[model samples]
Target: MIADGLNSKVFLAPMAGITDKPMRKLVHSFGAGNIVSEMVAINALSRRNAKTYRIADVRDEPYPVTVQLVGSEPKLFAESAKLVAELGAYSIDINMGCPVKKIVANKSGAYLMTEPKLAADIIKAVKQSIKLPVSVKFRKGWDHKSVNAVEFAKICQDSGADYLTIHGRTKSDMYSGNADWDIIAAVKQAVRIPVVGNGDIDSVYKAKEMIEYTKVDGVMIGRAALGRPWLIAQTHNYLENGLEPEETSITLIKQTMLEHISQLQKYYGEKMALALSRKYVCWYCKNLRNARKFREIYVKINNTEQAIAEIERFFAENGSDIDERS
Candidate 1:
């Protein structure tokens, strides 16, 4: 129950390479109302660069879109916020949790945690420069020993951030081990603004537990929904009405895969779409029977026609069979 009365609390994390417009639309079709765009470079967006503009584009995007931007400079951060507002973003999320080596090496993302003053400066600048709601995503800290998420949460709130997202692991953890929900609970305790808990929430049960335990206003999913965008609707339905989404069948899976491919084809072109779908194709088959054999063939798909053929062939061979893998 996000206070914004958005359709669902399950949010699509702003992945750097994965959450493109096509993918965002795919998730939206499956009942995600609060899809976040892929993270754009604040500096690039500040300059109104074409490539950055495309990523920040909300035209034809589903309602209440949250655009995420990354940068270390306060002025550029403020400019990017205004750019997103003009582009029709419902809210702006500052990227402080990205742990990629390049982003950290550049003194952006999680590295911002090491300098609370700069993090506050960026948030304050964006909050002051734009009329849109501003949010920040941050980690527990740079690492375990230096966990200062609570203090940072206070800084974000003090700087006028309307909401905060805490990915419970430190940058050093880097998607390793479990996300420390205890830290999330602590941060929620420290801040009055909505705290979104992100980490290790791979199931509705976990999602429910996090909401109940941490008392966070929302939950963000990253890798868990790769081929399961329906999980967003499912989470919403369960959280709101205490009902589970019917299990996705193989036939529905095939149909959804084709629909996703078609969207990708339209947005990214057939060749690039086919190549980009390789990972998602693998994710779709990861939990099915004969998945090992199916993945071996699916990963080798090189063209849209071949991809279509493989999709039909795999369902013909493994239809109605389900198991567990990733």
Candidate 2:
């Protein structure tokens, strides 16, 4: 939704289980770009489902949040868009690029790339249902041979989408190999609306590279943001101004990790947070000294006290070491 209502061009992709409220809040605190909610199922939401309501909640949030909805039915998509609007959503994004097996099997997500008619209908319905700016997130095509992002982007614009986000790989390619920025450039040339490029953008320099190569309006970062909440903020500053990213030390990472765990606890309670923090701890300690040894022991600790202790112990052992991974 960058350049529509957002003040920044950098966007955090709507990653399920990764961009939830706790993670969004953490990234926003660091001045990250537009943050999107995990995909909310419109089919369930149209029935006034309680679980979907909880997933779409952005009420009274200090940072702007875009709600991404996924489903095949146009009426249901429209209804869910209206409902999310009532929940203080800053904007709405329709998910047409998800490549998960179950999602594509349901005729939603990347499957829509093969069925342009339904994709356009869903976009039109959602746009008509709310005043919020609407955007479409899709991929290169249903497969490598069926490249249709250029055509799909045009259809979305014709259907009244305010902007479009195109991932650089086909559904068949999944997340493997290199992202095809060539297809992204093609889509940008094929449309007048602002186009955001997404796929394997993991560093500030790479984000700049994609912009220069694709001539895109903006860049969306996904997997790279894991364990590095300040990436969006850093990328934003680098792009908006001629500024370099600040150095990050091991100590700051530990503090940030602790804060993230605290938020997860506040949101999901102690028990669930304990299980969730395990994976996050691994992400945070990805390449630290003896990280494998730490992770091997950390994932087994089922209690909060032990987890916190392990985090404290790991960082204490490696003080003031800056992240050299990137």
Candidate 3:
């Protein structure tokens, strides 16, 4: 059962450089309630880069889509929100959780969490600029020493955020250890607007616990969905029927990879698709028999045709069963 509310509970996180339109469509087709596009730099949107315009486009999806913008400047942030709304975004999501060095150095992303006041200002500017619903996604805080999700949630709400998504780990933790659901619960308690719990929800059991324990309005899964976008649909089914997800077969996994590659080729040209698919290619091959050998072969190929051929040959000749537990 999809969580009923102003916003559906299951959202796809805005993974920069990865979750393009093709991948976003695939995740949605698999049953994600809400999805965010890849993070776009606010500064880039303001300048109206042709490449950014292509990335910001969201005309294909039928469901409500939120475009995430990252930046610390108030005026530019406001302008960017207006532009995105004009581009037909259902909502605007401000990213304060990205831990990339480039974003932090620019006083954006997770670094904004260090100053709740400034974070609030950016939200305020965006809300004031656009009529669409505005939200914020952020880490626990800048680091463990400064962990304060509750305070940040309040700041965002007071400034005009319609909802909040809290990634359980602190900025300092990066992608290590476990994401603390305790703090996410605290944020829920501190704010009246819906709270979306994120981080470390890699399984159906964890998804149920995060919602039931943290009392969050929704949940967002990140890295866990790398080669397994179907996890979102599996989670939705688990919530609805209590049925375990069927284990993904080696054949189906290979087919999915091929389809994903084909979609990338359609959206981006052959060269760009080949380049972007490398990381995904590596991810899909993980833990399989002869994966090392496949990686050795796949990484060396430069053309899409060769890469596809290598993938088909490896799976047909040496693929092993994947343990698709949920």
List candidate 2 stretches off by more than 4 Å.
320-323
Angstrom error of the Cα, residue 124, model 3: value is 1.5
Cα error, residue 27 of model 3, in Å, equals 0.8
After superposition, candidate 1 runs with Cα above 4 Å error: 1-7, 324-326
Give residue 230's error in model 3 in angstroms: 0.7
RMSD of each: 1.6, 1.3, 2.2
lDDT of each: 0.85, 0.89, 0.83
Worst 10 residues of 3 by lDDT: 1-10
- Candidate structures ordered by lDDT, highest first: 2, 1, 3
> Residues 1-326, candidate 3, lDDT per residue (tens digit)?
22222345677788988888878877877764577889888787777888898787776667777899999999999988888877778888899998889889999999998877888889989989988888899989888899888888899989989889999988889888899999999999999888999989888788888999999888888787888888877776786678698877787678888888999999998988888888887888777777787888887899987898898888878765444333
Top candidate when judged by lDDT against the true structure: 2
lDDT of 2 by residue, 1-326 (tens): 35556888899999988788899999999985899899998888877788778889899688889999998999989988999999989999999999999999999999999999999999999988999999999999999789989989999999999999999999998899999999999999999999999999988999999999999999999999998989999999999896898777777688889999999999889999988988888888876777888899988998889889988887777665534756
TM-score each candidate.
0.96, 0.97, 0.93
Q: Write the per-residue lDDT of candidate 1 for residues 82-115, one digit (tens) a residue.
A: 8788887888999998999988887799999999
**TM-score ranking from best to worst?**
2, 1, 3
Highest TM-score: which candidate? 2
